[model samples]
Target chain A: MTDISQSAAVPGTAPQRPAATLSARLARWLPRLVMAPSFLVVLIGVYLFIAWTLWISLSSSAMLPRYDFVGLEQYVRLWNTPRWHTAVINLFLFTGLFLAVTIALGLLMAILLDQNIRAEGVLRTVYLYPMALSFIVTGTAWKWVLNPELGVEKVVQSWGWDTFAFDWITRPETAIYCVVIAAVWQSTGFAMAIFLAGLRGIDSSIIKAAQIEGASLPRIYASIIVPLLRPAFLSVIVLLSYISIKSFDLVLALTNAGPGGSTEMPSTFMFAYTFQRNQMGVGAASAIMMLMTVAAIIIPYLYSELREDTHGH
Target chain B: MATLDINRVRKAYGNLEVLKEVNISVGDGEFLVLLGPSGCGKSTLLNIIAGLEDITGGEVLIGNRVVNDLPPKDRDIAMVFQSYALYPTMTVRQNIEFGMKIRGIPAEERAKATNAAAEMLQMTGLLDRKPSQLSGGQRQRVAMGRAIVRHPDLFLFDEPLSNLDAKLRVDMRTEIKRLHQRLGTTIVYVTHDQIEAMTLATKVAVMKGGVVQHFGPPQEVYDRPANTYVARFVGSPAMNIIPGWLLASDGVPTVAFDTPQGEAVVRGVPLSAETAHRFAGRDVLVGIRPEHFGLDPSGTVPVGVDVVEPTGPDTLIVFAAGGTEVVARLEPFDAQVGRQERFSVKAEKVVLFDPATETRLD
Candidate 1:
């Protein structure tokens, strides 16, 4: 017979041991049995997927996955390419313009709506309808309005002003501004929605306190209302940045990197190289670089913001 | 610094009338408390005076100027809200200095005023802390300090102490009373708690259902209430009101009620001859405060005790009297649950009201 103390003895109690217990074995294995599946899935699915992408970025495979390592050649070649460089520049330009214009216009619209206006429901619907539309629809509509030879230029010339030239969409130097205008048109409604929520959450008592403190309406908004809205500002900035980074469909339909690749963004660049050019190694490397760039800029700011949110002022 | 005259003011929100023909004139340097339950339009009246809410039809005179059209900033007043309403992101110093800075006060004076207000509130150590970092009581102090530093003509408070814990509320009440004594500023404060109103206000306005039922000194409002509502709303645990009939046949004027304490007669009131002649045998409400009830077994009015609650200093005896529920404050030694007891109502303190109008008959 097996010794009973081997399985069930309390190690620190005394010399005499109890008999082996079924409960002890069940207790040790219960938690592991419950947790093992989820842990294995995270390890094999998510972690391995990212690891495989990273490995592919470091290799020289095309179309399908292969294992011939090239040791940083893909990254070096990526930096030297003009299209990749132009995509990086356009990303910055689009993000900057998108953030500034959206927030400014959103704040204005939010303030106007807060004034106990009539037809408030109708006004909010009109301002917020753009967010409900798909990017494909938004891009198609703007492509018509922004087409230099067909849309605005044709209409203006018919008005008998031969000197009037609305040709920004056809010019290399000015095509990026067209993209920004359409981008703002598509997303300013979202900014307005966020800011409306934030402004509504402010206490009316504070507005009263400011007025009693001898603050005019302009001063009150500048000093008290805006300062209290920093969290809202940070949230809008992060959200608008995320949208600007993967901005593909609008660029593809409206500009198609026209006027000599002036509007090619990172998402468009990644799609072109991977599917059209069939350079999977270079595409994966570009995707990895974009991910790293976003993480490097956003993670630290989000870390501090979340910590402050949980820990408080 | 200023006298606020609210002359015959009425407020109506589309057809739901809120304040009905209210009028009051607050003298210079007086602390006036508007005491009422929620939905009584006390806060709405306060906001009207601050120029934050428009009165349907009335005139507001601050000092000598009619300020109905002036905005809140131009009204020369400061208000402390129940929520503190401090700018959550600004430091305490910045919050106190905000109004002064906007008014274009020089930096030196702004600093001096902030320091003086902070020192007075005992918040010197917390001047650098944001409002979110302060405890509830400390935040209350900061809110008050924000008002005091402005040196405005009038100060308004909207239930400023209701958010604090009980002990802290009492402490802040005393602090506010002392601050009023020191500052000597004209104030209009609103509160639902009668005790706070009594302790803080030089004059108390008791409101009900959007009308001022009574406005007088605290003792006058308590001792000689205008009507049944004033008598009941101005006291803690309220005055016991019993239904009875006014007897005017004999030379003496008295009220008669059949109580479990047996037949009780309250005398010694000089009734108006008009009321006496009109209500010869009409029903009336007899009001008596709890402290006036005595627990003498051989007294003229006899009652049976139901429950005795000891509250450290005084004991409360809930007894059946005059065919209605009556609570009497008795000495701890004189109260026992389920005991045979007799209670006497102080005859002079008995108040009579016409049952139909709920108005004082005297």
Candidate 2:
């Protein structure tokens, strides 16, 4: 109360009043100002690099940077390349398989854990621990396990089952599915954790009301529980799709875009052109295309979810 | 068409007993209310009858069929919980039709039942709206409609009006009573509100410490309580219990005590020899309802009024008499604060209980 009086008196007549207001303004703005330098530095670097890539793409840049300009010639060359088309087709194959498997596996795991089973804590830790590991580690572990000669095939031969052949990692047609399996194993745990929290947030009284009405458990879950979990499912789908589109390290570590580039995703293609082949122009174009694709898919879904949340309440 | 009987029901949690040997039999088409204060095990007893809770040692018979082993679904009882428990995802129509739909009722009949219930509850226009979209009183009506639509063997209400505001609670209480009257269904209702118990209950069972202290018609339980607990619990402004001494002198029984101004006498019959042996010439408690005390300044009972609470209908005067703080409900125009007023109580209206046992002497 005394402080209120003193502050009112001080603000009423003082030369330092303007300075005090100034200090308050500076206090609010200082963090953004301090954080601007690092971000601004990255922004400038990216601008120069992108301009340089655009300039080189117009020219016949080979293995190193060139400054000659030839409009749309390199774009025409990129369109004609069969490997570029293969990479685009393979991108969809890898992402589609990864998304489907991860969502299915996550929902199944979430439902199992929702049951009143014993040792739930232990089971949850086991399932969610995979999310903490890097996809590089997961992919490498699966790659070795699925390798024909060194791992599965050799082990099966030692067990006297020489006819058993496990060679998906060595074949171009079947290798995309192998990468999908590893990616699902890595991301399903994360999606399950998101869904598990949503399941727990549902009111227990609603479930009891269903039971008291003589509804069988499955019918109640199918008709009531699933519909209530729609918002949660939307969030899970959006998060997993983002992860699937940007899947680079897992594909690189598992198949290395090898066995004839069967598992080549967009991010992996961007990295290969930028670092391996020094085709940074094509790589930067692919990066911008990937960003646009994600925005186009995610923004509408997020906007609808937000509108429903606000208006429904 | 069903008469529910609870036979010697006892409930315990490990070492702590929650309800003790509770026996109540509700007749066909009777509205039996389990009335008590909070934590008095009234809700627990209701839960047992609804088959929502397992009775520790007892049998519950619904229409002569022992149903203690049945689940809540199999018991043919519908309970409207205190929280309403309306599924937030379901519309008002679906919530009412849920039980019928689950029982394989035809859609045409379900719609007919739902429309009839909605019309009866005056909730016709709000059928498609979810529970979250409805007001508190509307949601409460939906919960009741869910129970009424079932036409179950018995209706169980667990303090269903406790969550509503004061005015809405009163209105809904009357509505539920009217619904019961029209349907003539046997219902077991639970509430801590003595006013609701007195107004709506065909029979009242007053419980305390998990034991049924008294069970009878509401007026009978209020006017003639079986023990000190029931007498004090069944009335608003609570009964005034004063410490006194029992006297059985010269073949006549009476209670004698001293007030701040003078000594007083109360007329009553002492309990049996085995009951009187423990309380003869010993300190006892005399219970008198607040309304029983009236102004008769020259009638011998003298007390100084300490506080006066005027609530339109009656005035509650807190006074000291017989070495105990007593509250008397007096005519609003006659009572005043901070004055020595003489009050007279009828001898026939007083209830005497032995202090050692708390059981009514006469």
Which candidate ranks first by TM-score, i.e. highest?
1
**lDDT tens per residue, model 1, B294-316:** 76655666667788888977888
TM-score (C-alpha) between model 1 and the true structure: 0.91
Candidate 2 whole-model C-alpha lDDT, 0 to 1 = 0.83
Q: Give the distance in Å from residue A277's predicted Cα in candidate 2 to where it truly belongs.
A: 2.3
How many clashing pairs per prediction, in order? 2, 0
Kindly report the TM-score of the first chain in candidate 2. 0.84
Candidate 1 C-alpha lDDT tens digits along A110-160: 888988899988988888898888777887888888886778888998899
- Per-candidate Cα lDDT values, in order, are 0.86, 0.83
Q: Residue-wise lDDT of candidate 2 within B40-93, one digit each (tens)?
A: 999899878877678899888999999999887888888888888887778999
Hey, what RMSD does candidate 2 come out at? 4.1
Candidate 1: segments with Cα more than 4 A from true spot: A1-47, A62-65, A157-162, A309-313, B270-281
Stretch of 10 with least lDDT, candidate 2 chain A: A280-289
* Candidate 2 residue spans exceeding 4 A from truth: A1-101, A149-165, A308-312, B10-20, B37-40, B249-253, B256-264, B268-280, B321-324, B334-337
